[model samples]
Target: MPAINQQSEPVIEIRELVTYYGERKILDGINLTVESGEIMVVMGGSGSGKSTLLRHLLSLNRPAAGNIRLFGQEVNKLSSRALHQMRQRIGVSFQGGALFNSLNVEENVAFPLREHTRLDDNTIRIMARMKLEVVNLAGFEKLMPSQLSGGMIKRAALARAIVMDPKLLFFDEPSAGLDPVVSADLDELILRLRDAMGVTIVVVTHELESAFRIADRITVLDKGKILITGTTQEVKESDNPRVQNLLNRRTEDIPVNADEYLQRLTDDLAGL
Candidate 1:
């Protein structure tokens, strides 16, 4: 399905993207678009290529075939200088906070400024505090990662991600390790960031509640292909078995041979 509003250039446009890890295809002929200022969620079960697709969006992983355009610029064709400029316009937060253990919260937030701008130490510190404040961690600048709760660490990481005032933000599994209440709060914070910053957000997750709550549109991936792309309402109304399985949270009931099941269990146990 097409997006709700299509008057302007899409913040992100990907077509026929095929990515592979060696010979195994991770993303196959995937197509997607994220409109400016909209919250787009990419969702899937484990090994469904959601993260691979996000890597393309982040310019970390290029497609083996097809193209990715970010804000009208072809990502694959970007020169190093262009790519660097493009990266400055985007912010990314990983599933883990990815904060620097060596630096305090304020210094972690100030890292981008120090690397990318000519700002003095005092100015950078002040700006870092302001960004921390935006994420509700104003007075916690002096705190270390070990001193903060999981949610606080996540928020502090967010403050750092947005310190450069990016136009696009990518989040990988924002609610992965969080409790239900914390996950919901993270969802609300996502919405607030969208409204407050007017930035395009691309979130990769399998968390159904968080996906539905924060998404303006969603793309569901299955077996290296997009099962569907539509609004939350459209997805709910879909009659496709794959989509139904996801929405209804039903596991496959296909009967496995006893030996196969035992071997699978053994494999899992052996891996552990």
Candidate 2:
């Protein structure tokens, strides 16, 4: 397939992004930028708030204080209609593929077009099949989600994501359940999509090897704060101990308050 050949632009811009779930801060003062055609990976350990960060970026959760602009328009201030219009310019490939179990691959891929466009059924089918071809799943378009292999499911979801020909794409845990070989293949596919479609890609994954292989830059988060946003080599050679601990898989020593732990386990329900 031929490339989209678009000019460079800033697709995602965030400044001082702060998020909270009740009283606990999930993302603290995050500042980030993803230029067109870049593959920026967000990596963190469990509870490091990587998933929370993704949710905010996707506008699923409101942040306590921050500015987020996609395609030069501020997202937080947009109205319902404006937000929907803005979102149509981007696509998301969920962590689990999220293909409808009831729908075949082609229908799942075409669903977005059907909902968003005035196009006829044949046009939607042709477009969906074209994307399927792009993902190398052309012949399997009629197969049900349950019938496809793990990798095929991922590729199919990807085909759906790009069927809209979005300028930005977000992937959540793209390699989460796949084997090493399959994960590597998916990584290459991500790179190809970026190069061929010129889409700015943001991937949220905890897999270190895959992050190193596919990322143009990586943002590492710990305890709801950004450790560093740098190239693969820069991040790999980071001097921050937290970054080193995450990279080396070493355990971090977090001091626990005995009183707080006791309170959590023993809620004073006796008074009630």
Candidate 3:
């Protein structure tokens, strides 16, 4: 990734963000900033609210409190039309590729341009092929998603994600199910995307190696709170026990109060 201009405003900003599911808090008072042309990796274990944060950032789920600003506009304050327009400037490559099974690689990549732009079919096909080439999937455009390998599926999906040339790109678990070599290739592609396109990137994953490999800065989340946000070296040298435990993959034995545990069990039974 390239060095960002520190004088400019962040492309993505979250301020004291809070979210919940029923009575259980999912994200609590979170704050972070993603600068232009940077790759920010958000990593945590399951139930640590990393995915929830991504959902909120994508504007799929509204926060219970606080605010999210993308491109200098508060997301929650935008009207439906305005929000849709805002989304046009953003792109997301979902976990599982999220490519339509019915669509071939070319059609899958062209879907966004066809839906979002007024480009003619010939132009859309050309643009889709261009993005496919960027991801190194040029000659396989006619193949169905089912025909592609796991890495190819990911690359094809990435091509679709960048087809519109979004200002901000969100990647969900880009290395979740790949072999080591494939995972590293994906990581390199991510770095290239940020460096070549100068697009701000946010990657949500539990893959520690991938996070460390691609992040310009990393934000580690635990139980809905930010543990630390820093450069890879700073995170590696963190003295905070919780952060260290996460990095070392050490399980912490958290003592539970009997009363609180009983109350939680009683509450669950009552709800059931």
Quick one: best TM-score, which candidate? 3
Question: How do the residues 116-201 of candidate 3 rate in per-residue lDDT, one tens digit apiece?
Answer: 88989899999999999999998998999999999999999999989989999999999999999999999999888888888999
What CA root-mean-square deviation does each model show from the true structure?
A: 4.2, 3.0, 1.9
Residue 185, model 2: Cα distance from true site in angstroms: 0.5
The lDDT leader among the candidates is: 3
Q: lDDT per prediction?
A: 0.90, 0.91, 0.93
lDDT of 1: 0.90
User: Lowest-lDDT window of 10 residues in candidate 3?
Assistant: 263-272
Candidate 1 per-residue C-alpha lDDT over 120-204 given as tens digits, one digit per residue, 9 for 90 to 100: 9999999999988888898888888889888888888888899999999999999999999988988898889888888889999
Estimated TM-score for each candidate: 0.90, 0.92, 0.95
Count clashing residue pairs in model 3: 0
Which digits, one per residue and each the tens of the lDDT, describe model 2 over residues 1-272? 22322465578899999988889988899999887778899999988899998998899988899898898888989999999998888899999999999999999999999999999999999999999988889899789999999999999999989988998899999999999999999999999998788788999999999999999889998989999999899998999999999999999898999999999887987687
Model 1 alpha-carbon miss at residue 100, Å: 1.3
